[model samples]
Target chain A: MSSDVKRLSLILLFSPFALWIVLLILLPHIGMVALSLREKVAPRVYEFGFGNYIDFINEPIYWNTLLRTGSMSLLVTALALLIGFPVAYYIAKIAGKRSRGALFLMCLIPLWVSDLIRAFGWILLLRETGVISSFLIWTGMTDHGIEFLYNDVTVIIGLVYTVILFMIVPLVSTLDGMGDDMIEAGYNLGGNSLTVLRRIIIPYAMPGIVAGCIVVFMLTAGSYLTPILLGGKNSSWFTEQIYDQFITRFNWESGAAFGFLLLAFTSFVVWLGLRLSGQSLTNTVART
Target chain B: MARANTSKALLFGYQAYIVAFFVFLAAPLVAAGTFAFNDSLFPSLPWQGFTLDWFFNDTEPKLGMFHDRRLLRGLYYSFVIALMVSTLSVAVGTTNAFLFVRREFPYKNFFYILMIVPLVIPGVILGISILVLASNVANTADDRFGIELEFLRPGLFLVVLGQFSFITTITSLVITARLRKCDLSLEEAAYNLGAGRARVLFTITLPFLRPAMIASGIVAFLVSFENFNTTLFLVGSESPLTITMYDRMAKVGSTPVLNAVSFFLMVGSGLLALISVVVQRPAPSE
Candidate 1:
């Protein structure tokens, strides 16, 4: 086809989906942001004002929950990287080829399960009388099961478990794309493993590290199901508040405001994650 | 230089820890699946005996692991809802792919960002918005038109709609990525050769997108099957398989049956994913 005609055809083909995208998704999100400045009425009515944002900023619960959620997500991301990097490195670089695929697949089995099921399973495993407790008791570590569930431990565990795969896969893909030949090249130059790692491996794996961190971090931060299911009554997370505002309370304006806050928090963290890790948010998004 | 060797030991320790962590992370899931087959009614430990009876067993009150009706109903509902979600998402996604690749409408970047935003938004928020919107619609419709839309009244259709909001984005993104690889010029060439846009799409572009579409479909199904926050608000007295399992784990507090459901889902989805991997063959060389 001729260039002009092709361009014209492209224009023709794209119009409807583009319009739908704009209308359905873009408008709703923009509407959400717009609604954040308003006040809720009897039901669905939005009274235009800055009251919602004022309430949002003034509330200590919002700030504290928001801060804790962000920090928790960050902690989970860091923990996942610490935990997953070696496994990814081993499978991608050091492991024997015959066993590598099997091991990696085994690592991934949990990822395919539903988040709800996993959360429930975690509760069962971590409940004071549950399987994990039983194991602890049997080991004579304590006569009673340790208080693991409905605390910070279970929430952290749940978050880390859910998002760890995100961290590992990106790191694996980046490492595999790089291959391990560079390490040998560094070693041939009389450098030790640490030197090679610092000088060679880290630079190549930077993209993966950044990509993995952002993907996992954002997921953990925005998550509601994990914290709700595992955190129990005392271990409240902010997304639960947001969910309650929208669902049980039937407060749309407040819900919209809260959601907008969540969005901003996510975007800011994503931007920070990219900057700190030295990769673009675009890169991280694609990796996931 | 001497200190650097310590780093190696540390790395080794970290590696060992990771392997242990993998076991830690994965043990519960494996236990859940394994315990499902246990003849004992307990979720953990104390196996009465090895038996396939759980898979085929029936209790008089019908609370037996295999004989539960509500669980079966939930499974049926989940599958139906998943099927609906996958079908809708695939359609929207494929069309969005066509639009993304072939057309150059106004505010393209704006639309692109909008389509991608939901990927980042938590499921909780999305579910909340849909519930708000649907309930409002249902209420207004009842008052104004006196027309009762059962689906809009927080049931299967509501769940499907809620899921479509986010899962559709997943489908579109996957399809869009594949479609980007497919040069738009071919479709134009076919058009220049006098084939209509529909023909060009169905014959050429659709085939290229088939694998991706199938993948998107499977992912959509998986997403919907496990959907919680969104489905929670939208679901009625009946529940999906996951939600049912969740309620049992939370309210009733003790049921080996929940693990049975998990095992069934784990094995089922795992097998489907395995088949997809073998068939899709991610590595082009292999």
Candidate 2:
């Protein structure tokens, strides 16, 4: 190939990537960072400063919501891992070949639908006059319908439902590659299932577990619809604050600051998770 | 003997747990689907005679989703947006896949790491960042150049762009996975047999990638269709079905008509999921 032709083909292939990464991803994020740094001194007047970040520190509600959102996301990640691991184990290690694929597909069905639909489904079943409440009344478990919406527990349940599939997919893929003989050998050495799971399985599955946890944490923390819809007035989610800043308040500076705070917090947690678990970002991201 | 019995009991309990887990997963969706056909306007309650009004009615109070003009328009807009997003994502994704797999450049690792940034960034951030940048540009244009850029406004065009940003990562990953496994010997043979580069790409490379492209295209379409967080910030006067549904759910509360819409989305997406699974499944036989 001639030099010009080679150069042309190379540019053709690289230009799309350049336009996508540079124009879309890098520039917008940099713009957001710049927006966050702006301090509105007067009407249609602005200067670069840390006023927005300082404001976040000064307001207890703002920082508290950030803390609450972060901790809640951590809780959701723990819950998803706890709930998903056993199911993944079943589908990976215990199920027959034909049933394995079937079971795996079942896990994915809920994910294919929109999160709005999933949240809506929970509403139909959990509202005061909803199905589960009415069923409780009929079964004489309670005389009156109970309002299950707009609470912390309800929000957690909704989040767990939304993110558990992510945990399970990675978990199952990791476990499927493990040999049955490993488990058999653990048993042969008089180790119980718990010991084997703790000593052998957990360490083996660390990469996947960390990957799943990272994805779930980022998703749960960043999630807007679930917390907003299910938690309602009580949500107090940081994303809600960001939304208020941007849309309701039309304060893009503070919104941008809050957005960065979220990105930074989530990134720190993801970094810590990778560090503790000794998993590379590339490998973890590959599994996802 | 006691140990064996205990283990057997544990197995039984484990099976029961699995059953319960699936029930938990399916409860909400099943309830939503059931209430769609319920006779009452409210989504829940005692069975008020089976009726198709939620799906078919077009009267004063019981307007079905099909008859709801706003919802239908939202659905149309969603389709068009998803179509554009999936196409752009797949095209750029394929280009990136080729670049990553077949070429060597300086800072390739840096670019590879940069590519993963979109996948981890929250959807809300992605939406707002683009919004901020576009607004800044628009303001600058209006202030100095005395020009208006409608496309940069919070509209369907921006919505498509925002979705394509992250979706391209997924399609790129899928195509790269397939492209890595492609045998280069076949390409070499084609080159030796008097075939040009473009011809080889069109005939061999593209055909090899056809399955991954189709699969990722379906995934891209569905992801864009279901997207809400990013779309919410970018949407203007027009809304997609998810956004519209969110408005009704948040503002007006639940109606059986919304339940009807949920039913249709469930089925449509279920079929798409099934198709992708079937297409990606490895063929049988040794």
Candidate 3:
């Protein structure tokens, strides 16, 4: 193809994608940032300032819920890593080829299901009159029925269950790529199993660990259905606040500000995670 | 001998831990599936007699999910939106994948990072941002052009647009992975044989990408169909199945029919996943 023809074909093939990214993703976010900076004074009157962001700072509930959501998401990420590492190790390193495929599929099935239905599943298991409560009553572990839903513990459980697969898939891929000889070498060098795990295995799996944490943290923080359904009346999830502002209260300015703040906060957390793990964002996403 | 025994014990412990984890992961789904058949009003346990009322009952005091018109309409809308989103996403994503993987352009790194911003951003935020943008566009069109873009109004069209924004990125990533692994020598050979560019692309390149396209299409469909967080903001009067389910669960609490719906969704998605696995399975000789 000639130079002109090559350039024309490139434009023809690429403009639709470029148009999509610029029009949908970039413009909307830019509009949101613009909206976030301005404060609505009356029905149609608006003034450009940091008033929306300042409102968030002045409101204790907003910042408090923000911090709570972040810390809880971090806790969920940690719990998922703790639970996922062993299962990933088994599937990647120990299981036979056929069984490994089956195990991975088993983990993936729940991921494909809707998050709403999964939250409902937890309700069936943990609600006041649900299966576990009944079981506990039958076993004489509790008097009458105990309410297991509508609490922070239930919210954490639901969040972890919802995001565990994100952790496992990445960890499995990373661990699967590792050579078993590395571990054997550590043992040969008089290193105990825990030492080998800490020194050799964890470092080798750092990319996957970082990738999983990023995904889990984002999902847990942004989740709305799981926290609301499982946490019930007293949820106070930050996403719920965003939902209330935009949908319930019809305050798009404040909602947009909260949305931008969430994006900033999650990005910062991801950066900190990558920095602490010594893995770059490009490396982590490429691994995924 | 002592070291071997210790290792054996450790292996046993690991096996037990994996078993427990599997049970924990699966128990909720199993519980939901079982109670779908329970002949009672509540989804929770009371050892009610087994019945299919929730699935097929059309009588008074026992309406099946399938028999409910609203739920059925929600399901229909969900399928329609998912179909449109997947088709659009696949078309745009496939082209973008080729653009990124096959050819280099200026500002490619900048654009690449911008494209991924939607994926990491929260769905709630994405929904609100799109909602704000679309409304702004609608207002502009009405004021300047004296025309109303019906698609920009909150409905299936906006839902498709909102979902397409992020889902296209996912599809592009899947196709890019396949494209990277694909052998380039075949394309070069085809071109060397005097095959036209279009011919080489259709016969050599597209054939190699068919599997990834199909897999990504399935993923895009599922993501759009089950989407609630983003669709909630974009939906006007036409609610998807997820939104309807959320409303019912929150308002009326748990019902047997809800369980039935959950069971059906599980089975449908499970079958789709199984088919994808089967399609991707290696040939027997290999």
Candidate 4:
């Protein structure tokens, strides 16, 4: 192709990408930051300031929920990793080839459904008049049905259930690439299974672990439907505060501020997680 | 011998743990699916005989999803929105695949990182940011020129835009992966055979990308259909099925009708997922 033709083609190809990145992702976020930096001085009037962010710190409920949401998300990420690592290991290393494909498909089935449906499913099992409570009554474990929903534990469980597949996919892919001979070598060098795992497997899967943790943590922290539906009145999720600012109270200024606060929190934690795991974003992105 | 025996025990324990994990994963969905056919109105308790009333009944109290006008309309709206979002996303995604793979530019790595930002940020924040910017533009337009940009307001149009924003990033990733795997030699061979650039692109390049485009289209469709967090903010008067179902679950708690709807959604999405997987697999040799 001629240089002119090549340049034309390049520009044509680049236009859509440039438009999408600038108009959709870049500008909207910039607008959000700008909106957040302003203060509502009077009716239909505003001034640029940090008053919105200051409000977040001054209000105990706001900061408390932010901390709670952050901590809870960390807890959920840890739980997902703990639960997902073993299952991923089994799928990647232990299962026969045919069963490996089938097991991986089973892991992915939950993701086909929406988070709302999953939360609905949890409600069916954990609600006051739900299946597990009824089963417990039939088994004579308790005299009355227990409302298992609307607690921190329930929210954490729901979050873990929703995000475990994300954790497992990266884990399985990374673990699948690891050679079995390495494990045997570790065992041959006077190492037990635990030692082999600690030495040979976890180190090899560090990129996948970091990748999974970033995704699960982001999803957990940003989640809205699971916490609200499962936790109900006591949800106190930071996303709920943002929702109240925009939809309930119609305070767009503060809503934008809260949104940026959340983005910052998630970004900081993700950076911290990558540092601790000794993996960079490029490595995690490549593995996933 | 003792170490071997302990390893066997550990293997048994690992197998049992996997079984328990699968149970934990499958239990909630299974419970929800089971109660859809229960004879009772409530979604729990007594071994009520099987009935498809929740799927078929058009009564005052036991309104089925198929017969309910509002629910069906919501489903239709979701379908239309998903259709628009997927088409736009796939079209843009194809160009994105070409740009990222075949071309070189300054700040390419920076742009790539920017592309991933939409995926990582909270969906609600995405919704809110778009809402803020769009509305600000709309207000400015109305104030200065006395013009009404209805599309910028919180409506179905905004909903489609909100979903398309992030979903395009996903489709781009899928197509980019497929494009990276394409053999440039084949395109060179096409060019050597006296084919023009456009002709080569149409006949050789696009056909190679057909499966990926279809797969990403299916993914984009499913993501848009099931979206709630972004849709919740951008929805105007007309709500989609997810928002409608969310409202119902919040209000009525556990109704068998909702379970019936969940069953259908699960089956529908499962079939789409199956098709996408099948399409992405390489065709068998004769």
Q: Model 2's DockQ?
A: 0.80
Candidate 2 RMSD to the real structure: 1.5
Tens-digit lDDT track of model 4 for B136-170: 89999999999999999999999999999999988
* Regions of candidate 4 where Cα sits further than 4 Å from its true position: none
Worst 10 residues of 1 chain A by lDDT: A16-25
Over the true interface residues, superposed, what is the Cα RMSD of model 3? Answer: 1.2
Model 2 chain A lDDT-worst window of ten? A279-288
Cα lDDT of model 1 by residue, A176-205, tens digit: 878567788999999987899889988988
Task: Give the poorly placed runs of model 2, Cα more than 4 Å off.
Answer: A2-4
- Each candidate structure's TM-score, on Cα atoms with residue i matched to residue i, is 0.86, 0.97, 0.97, 0.97
Clashing pairs in 4: none
What's the candidate order when arranged by decreasing lDDT?
Answer: 2, 4, 3, 1
Error of 4 at B245 (Å): 0.4
Candidate 4 lDDT, A193-222, residue by residue in tens? 789889889999998998898888998999
For model 2, the docking class works out as high
Candidate 3 TM-score, true structure as reference: 0.97
lDDT tens readout by residue for model 3, B1-286: 9989999999999999999999999988888888889988888778889999998999756789889888899999999999999999988888888888888899887777666666777888889889999998999999999999878989988899899988887888888888888899998999899999889989999988888888889889988988888898999899999999999987888888888998999999898888877766656974
List candidate 3 segments past 4 Å from native.
B284-286
